[model samples]
Target: MFSGNGHGKLVGSTQVDELGVLESPVVLTATLSVFRAADALLSWLMERRPDGVSFNPLVGETNDGHLSDIRRRPITEDHVLAAVAQASDGPPAEGCVGAGAGTTALGFKAGIGTSSRTVRTAGRTGTVGALVQSNFGGVLTVLGVPMPADELVPAADRTEPPGNSCMIVVATDLPVDARQLGRLARRAVFAMARVGASFSSTSGDYAIAFTTSDQPPIPDGEIDPVFAAVLDAVEEALLNSLFTAVTTTGVGGRTSHAVPHRAVIERLTAAGRLPAPPLIPESPSETRLRTTPARDEPGS
Candidate 1:
């Protein structure tokens, strides 16, 4: 019997989808929340106005087993709101957080990973955001890099992980409709492929997208500025998810290495895809820096 949900921070009897609606803008929760979290988020779309409202909510998920107790149903209203409320406009940090708590990829630690690319069109520029629940299996190869047989875990290994599931949520302030957004979602599958995921047979690779473009409801129309924005943002957000997610380790004693952030930055710089990190300044002759509350040193 499921337990934690509301009366006790999480009423166990209440499924994640039972959250109803939010009184604020944007909300997030992982799987099992196909209803409550999504509905509440859409409900929040009308927070400012008492008038009726409708919005297709954005939600993403990755299976969490290696690091979290999947059977507990620990996710709660507080957790969903926290994810959305804490979301920053800039690049999102990745790996083992948010929707990735109990996920795995190719038998390794995989949860949510994001990546983004900058695109310049016409004269206007905008940022696209991507959130992912990374749980799939293919192989581990980055930018045509080879995975040595030594590091290769045979797909049939007893310890090998199951083909997992993932959900990608793309958001843009761009002007676009549901159809365009759907196309953008499909493209995201390719982006994942580039990072070593082959869309396993037992895995589910679904994606959804939304836009914040402000426009009058149209029964039908021609060119769409918002639609264009969605494509641009979606492309970038996927990249960002891949970019910011560090490797992680979750449940079952399996360790999922976060793509080391510093190492990735260095690799990007080598590929000329990124500029070098700025240098740190040395202290002046008259100035001295010290580590506060020095850590304990044995036999100091």
Candidate 2:
């Protein structure tokens, strides 16, 4: 795990930091409900383990009070259980869902976002994926292009929260130990700057990275490609969060407007940064297959 700022709560982080292992699925929720979420997660994990064996419940959180009735502590144990039971292996739904339902970021309605990238190193190839709860403040930028200063957001729909935070989870199918995962996690946090994250004093910018491979750990010398892949995937995921989230109104009628997609496209196009649309649209599966490096590539 890597923390750019330590202002926010991340239950189980101390354990993970000391042991370099996460034995439980991560639960993310509103800041005020983190303890409840942790307790619920602990309960769920304990039911599967023998009695008297304590477990650390990995729960992370961001303040969503600006757009939700956080004082109400709306999240319940049932919600956590339901999420666990409904977890899927396929692509996850992103934007304004799950723990990100009432979150805002970069002056826009932001939420859950996900992305993945393939890497080839030495004679092996693997994939790195990132999921982000993007609720941090910054001057919004996409692909190194800053949003136009003249672009006006209505005062009533602005997100002027007192503070912000972001949580990032990274997963890979490469063989790497906790030390390597820690490096990858740091890279993930660094990528936030690519999309204009401020990493403010009041922001909790944390990343947790883990791998699913059981093979021999990759040599540290060959880990560069994987690190590069993390940067790309995380930057894309942050942008995805901003682009896909819809406008939302929450507590006291405070509102957060969605990114102005058309204007952003126009700005990028005018800057000659927008790629032309493909003549032949590819299916999602085909695109995935094409982007992924072959497992048995000649060098790999």
| Regions of candidate 2 where Cα sits further than 4 Å from its true position | 148-156, 275-300
lDDT comparing candidate 1 with the true structure: 0.47
- Total residue pair clashes for candidate 2: 0
- Which candidate leads in TM-score? 2
Prediction 2 global C-alpha lDDT: 0.81
Candidate 1 residue 256 Cα shift, in angstroms, is 3.3
- The reply for model 1, stretches above 4 Å from the true place, is 1-58, 148-160, 215-252, 258-300
Lowest-sum lDDT 10-residue window in model 1:
1-10
Model 1 TM-score? 0.59
Score each candidate by Cα lDDT. 0.47, 0.81
lDDT tens digits, residues 1-300, model 1? 111111111212122234322234433344454355665555455554567654445443444444554444555555555556676667565644555555556444444556444434334454556666666666545554533212533332234345656566666655555555555556555556655666656566665555576643222343244344444443344334443444443344444443334444455577766678795222121221111112342100
Using all chains and alpha carbons, the TM-scores for the candidates as numbered come to: 0.59, 0.89
